[model samples]
Target: MTSVSIAERLGQEKFLAQTYNRDFLHVPGAFADPGGLVSFNVLSDLIARHRLEPPRLRLTVDGETLPQHRYAVPVITRRNTRWDRVHPDELHQRLAKGASLVIDQIDHLHEPVGDLAASLEGWLRAGVQVNAYASWTSTEGFGVHWDDHDVIVVQIEGAKRWRIFGPTRSLPLHRDVVEPEPPPAEPVAELVLTAGDVLYLPRGWWHAVTADQGVHSLHLTCGISPPHTGARLVGWLADELLASDIFRTDLPIHAGPEAQAAFLSALRKEVIGALDDSGLLERYAAARDAECVGRLRPSLPYVQGVPADPELMVRLTTGRARLDIVMAEGETVTRLTGAGQQVDAAPAAGPILHRLLNVGWHRLGDLADTAGVSVADTAALVAELVGAQIATVRSEGR
Candidate 1:
């Protein structure tokens, strides 16, 4: 949306030490024309036209969901359904009378927002999910709450006031041990975000938002992906260690104390052994990155292999898919990256993969000499990735 990079908005690694998770940040006029952030009319139209389902489409008020039938077609609310229990019609009436309307994960349905999210992933080096929240009047949505993850707020249109209380808890998780204490009565800082204004609030900070600016409000909250934690690593380690014979052995549920102690010692030794590996966590993160599947959209019409057209654009769907790299016999080696899997090519493949990875798209002829392959052959290789949905092919003029 704006030429301003995410690094510029949130600052980079050097700034991370000083600014991250410490205080509230507000950047005004981040976009040249702030009103162009998103289309409020289009969003409202989508809500009326589409049959938004639960988990995807939800209306929350005071931290509870409203029934679906009232918002959708005029029909009976299914008794056991999640929406029926929440009673959305009543919630809408309450919102019209000043209630907060929150729709989680709105990027799934919206296209403009999705494009922004993809761009952000390229900049942030991690996955990003955008949620939409709309409100009328001055009523607060969730009434003084803190999110478990950091958020980048883009005010699409209208205006909203934010009261930030900061966080009492540190790096809290969704399944946290204890809930954070109520925010202080007086806010540590107050901010009013106009269209195109951007705000960054780290996770665990207490904040409240309302469309109290005398006009309807619409905004998107882009949630940042959290760094890998020890909990995740241990969980992955447990799975990896299942190959060991001791780990495969059954628990000594009814065994004698001596037998149980021996069993416990064996398990601990195996767990500790895995932890001792200096590269274990790095390997785990690489594995996780390779497996991550970002939003995969279909490429219609040319369902078959991609044509060897130089103008056809391509990009990877997943942000974390690593390029392949491998060492070989004697002095020869291979380094492959991008387009899902990497292949050990002759020395020529290095420049080709390097070029493609460095830039979003390149002409087939451009990579032909570098990869030691013809333009058609390169197209076939790209087609393989397109078929895998890891890469996409878009015609230039269409």
Candidate 2:
């Protein structure tokens, strides 16, 4: 998080607003130290330490997945067709040679990466997930293909040549009825991305990448701003109108066409009425933000409740945690956004949440001072969060 505004980092909002569905964008040299943001050594260490399985951790060439045994042998092959042992050295050598490596859901494996994704989601006002990709040679792993969602690409090391052909479909999705038409034979643009370059490619944009610059390349693709679909709208509506008898009734599958048509007509009215509200989108956005289950991590020591310790440092464990104010019984309630958790403190939790939401880091004493509460009380509150896995406390190495 540099202090750069979303609009500034994204260039002109109007430009994106206009061309968002029509074309692709390439912002070269966007970051000063892209490679430094995440370390390849750390990622390699994690993959080996965790023994992560794929398609989560797979090497691909031309849209085909290389056999796991090519690198990793099964120390224990299971009845479920899964293996426990994977060859890290062989996998590393393949990546260093030019094969594409995809580590899906990178956030789950790394804390810094997860935090960065959450921060972007907050800034962009949408959900974001980061996937890490690495390549060593001049082979196209996925070939010329389009993603179902928009991606923010950060080139971490070496150099990668990107041939951008732009988008053929308008706002495509993973579960859409129609796919985009084939991309043009010729690329619309060609660009070389080196360390620290950031690229934005809209969904349905056909592009190809290769490490032709003769160096190994590692990058993180932060997928952002997934669009809400009709299916989602209906799902949300069903949850909201669960109390309605007609909605809760079983479908008239056994009825005649006329009877079914009548049933559908009524359902349509209710669905349309729900969507017609001006606040529908905003409400959906909020609900989605609040319900997001971030990377769950447990905090040691504070197993029961937070101690009244003044020197403890606390930070949110989840990147997308929400803090809001609501009036209940003529008093304001401090509502924690994600996971629908809330606390009814003596107007003191408000300051704690304010500091939690806006600041990246907080010490127990500072939060207590802001809330006009004792350090011990603040520690107790933090302990509760730790128990819920929503916040973590760092111990000063004594």
Q: List lDDT for all candidates, in order.
A: 0.70, 0.75
Clashing pairs in 2: 72-87, 98-136, 98-137, 306-383, 308-376, 322-337
Candidate 2 lDDT over residue span 296-348, tens digit each: 66666667666777777787755567776778799887766654454445566
In model 1, the clashing pairs are 66-88, 67-87, 67-88, 95-99, 323-337, 324-336
Instruction: Give the candidate number with the greatest TM-score.
Output: 2
Residue 162 accuracy (lDDT) in model 2: 94
For candidate 2, the TM-score is 0.87
Please give, for residues 1-398, the per-residue lDDT of candidate 1 as tens digits. Answer: 53135457666664467776666688887765644545766666666666556756666666666666545544345574332234446656756866556666666566556666666655555567888887777777677899887788988778999999988887777877898887789989999998878898888899988885657788889897764567878888889998999988999999999999999999999888898999997788676665656667666667977888766766666655555556677556544433344445556455665655532445667766666777777777667667776666677668
lDDT, model 1, position 130? 86
* Alpha-carbon RMSD of each model: 4.9, 3.4
Clashes of each: 6, 6
Query: Which 10 residues in a row give candidate 1 its minimum summed lDDT?
Result: 80-89
Model 2 segments more than 4 A misplaced: 1-7, 12-22, 76-89, 250-266
